[model samples]
Target: MSGLDQRRVLVTGASGTFGRQLCAAFTAAGARVVGVDRQPGSIDGVPVLGCDLTDPATVPPVVAAAVDRLGGLDLLVNNAGVGGPAPAELPPDEVVRQQLEVNLLAAWRTTAAALPALEAARGRVVFVASRMALLPLPLAAAYGVSKRALVAYADALRHEVGTHVGVSVVYPSMVASPIHDSTADAGLSLEGVSRPEPVQGVVAAILRAATARRAPRDVATTRRGRLELAFARHAPTLADRLVRRTVATRIAAGDLDAAPLAAGMLRRHRDATG
Candidate 1:
């Protein structure tokens, strides 16, 4: 029998690409999966509850209600997050706060709400943090900050609860999905960026992390991503410079429109390296 057989999973963002795939994959593994999203959603057969993660008041009630329906929770997948390739210019406080609330605080709130059931069930927590958590890209400042905070929160949670609850954070880099479509529609060219890995690989990694004997502390999907992570962690100066160069080049090519701040960031990285 599969380890995941009969596991009860609560996955947020069930309407998105990864979310839909997660529900299908878990269901295929014989898991009883419940999803929370923000739309009139349908996904083959998964039961989805609509709840805006950004709403503080909605999450606990929504999650409590979902867990009640499931008879308990065995896994809580904190997959609801939003923030895209940001311009180098500082965004409005509203924009930044919105991203922070959704990408970081929502996950924290969801995990807090799920902890009681998870502890009772010895369940797992899977955080879908982006590779931006480590390799902070130039344009996506808000995204990078939120993802990094998510990873940090996961770490702290693991220390607080890992003996009884499995904690894992998946850091997949570039994946071809709806995100790219949105970026493209905004007229941003991701051309010449490393080819995004298949969506299948991304989901597979999440499943593996969720079901591992001992949950991995961190998981990265791409070799390039892992290397970038290493450099960012061990050689921040160099990582900063390389990331800046990439951004500066994109700006020069007109693929990005962040010349002013990108140039300053690049200069700072250079000075820090020297």
Candidate 2:
């Protein structure tokens, strides 16, 4: 984990915005990289295997293939995730299930499959979580819940495997990607609520975590993200108040007016505060 040179790395979601950049960066640093994605292709000269990570039956064999291709696994980056908006007031639905399956369970299964190779090499695992895991927003319950659960999984994995395999979680603030397409289509666009950061910074943060002398417990991609994480952790009540205010302002401005999925919460917010 001290460096990337000659390291055999397997990254999930290799065809994604962050995944492509990550492969390029790692390749430039002299690491042997392979990627797993739903779309099998090459990114930055890195080969990506096509696999549906959410399918429990396929993750093990896909991971084994990557390990065998790389000769051995030195690092596993769980970068694959999906996002959508689901209101907290609503009952769990397909959106909720998809988020949990992809964002949380997919990483868990991938990591579990990669553990033997990682432990044998005394390697590392880095999970690409999100700022939502720490500081959540309204109308995006699925994404928040899944990411938070991913972090919890990472924490537990660290406890169980800390002796040999290093575990780390990197939280990036909003990065503009197709991951937000579903949310935008749902009329819950985070246009003003969350700032979209560059994908490079997030990739860099993940690289740092992968190469750090000792795997850091949690890493935030930007200065603002670190502050947000600290505020959410140290003063949760205040953090809640701030989030409430943002949601209220958005509601007052009719931001959620077009989102039918947000109707119940919008009606309740208007009734209670009007």
Candidate 2, 224-246: lDDT as tens digits: 99999999999999989988898
Alpha carbon lDDT at 167, candidate 2: 96
Error of 1 at 197 (Å): 1.5
Indicate the TM-score of model 2.
0.98
Worst 10 residues of 1 by lDDT: 256-265
TM-score of decoy 1:
0.88
lDDT of 1 by residue, 1-274 (tens): 1278988999998988799999999999999999999874568888898898888899999899889989999999888877655655665466568778988999999999999999999889999998878877655677789999999999999999999998999887776666556446545545655457777777888898888888888887767767877887899999878766776576556664444434555565557757
In angstroms, the error of model 1 at 24 is 0.7
Clashing pairs in 1: none
Residue 24 accuracy (lDDT) in model 2? 94
The TM-scores of all predictions, comma-separated, are 0.88, 0.98
Cα distance off (Å), candidate 1, residue 213? 0.4
Best by TM-score: 2
Superposed on all Cα atoms, the candidates' RMSDs to the truth, in angstroms, are 3.4, 0.9
